[model samples]
Target: MELENIRRRKQELLVEIQRLREELSEAMSEVEGLEANEGSKTLQRNRKMAMGRKKFNMDPKKGIQFLVENELLQNTPEEIARFLYKGEGLNKTAIGD
Candidate 1:
């Protein structure tokens, strides 16, 4: 009788251990997901802050002239404008002529 009771108790302990292991696995998955989400948010916030700090408000025409007068750029104004606005989805109208 005592042996039967010991076996039943062992079975119960095994079931409890399995339940704990499943709970731990789910908790670990949730932690990993939260960590990944936090990392992504941090990266986006950093990009936004960097972009906010780096402002290029120069007029394209004046910028081109300055570069040429300073001997800093050898390209023509048209070429410089094309280079600046290339792939930016902006047209010459945005530059006010």
Candidate 2:
């Protein structure tokens, strides 16, 4: 009786693990889809303007200091990221004004 119970529990754990693996596979595919679709027109324009460069060369600390001293930028990092990636208001709730 004890051996049968152990076998049953082991089978149950194997089934659960398989289900979790399938879920993880689906999630990874969704992430790949998002990455493939991330290149919008505005982003493509920005890439072209950079002349094949992958990343910016500016120092973030100095940039922040300049913005603060000149009062040129007012938004938070999250808000600025939304504007940059064009995902603004995507996750906003209806109750959020």
Candidate 3:
């Protein structure tokens, strides 16, 4: 009778262990999914640059001459912003504005 009880207890323990293992696997899967989602949600360099684009759009003028001269106007606002403080001849040396 005692041996039978021991066998039954052993069976119960195995079942409990298996259930715990399954729960752990599910938790690991959820962690992996969360990591994947976080990676996907990461912002691209272009998006970050776009956010910083507001500083470059200096003048209100829009034309071929403006584009050729400024060069920033040729691209999107983001691009213009990245190159805002960069490069030479951004400002004209004219005596008057």
By lDDT, the best candidate is 1
* Candidate 2: segments with Cα more than 4 A from true spot: 40-97
Quote the positional error of residue 18 for candidate 3 in Å. 0.7
Model 2 worst lDDT run, 10 consecutive residues: 88-97
TM-scores of the models, in the order given: 0.55, 0.43, 0.49
Model 3, residue 97: displacement in angstroms?
14
lDDT value, candidate 3, whole model: 0.53
Best by TM-score: 1
Q: After superposition, how far is residue 78 of candidate 2 from its true place, in Å?
A: 21
- Stretches of candidate 3 off by over 4 Å are 44-97
Q: Which of 1 and 3 is ahead in TM-score?
A: 1
Instruction: Summarize candidate 3's per-residue lDDT along 6-83 as a digit string, tens digits.
Output: 999999999999999999999999999999877765644334333333222343233223543544245666644444
Predicted candidate 1 versus true structure: per-residue lDDT over 8-28, tens digit per residue: 999999999999999999999
* Error at 54, model 1, angstroms: 2.6
**Model 2 TM-score on a 0 to 1 scale:** 0.43
lDDT scores in order: 0.61, 0.52, 0.53
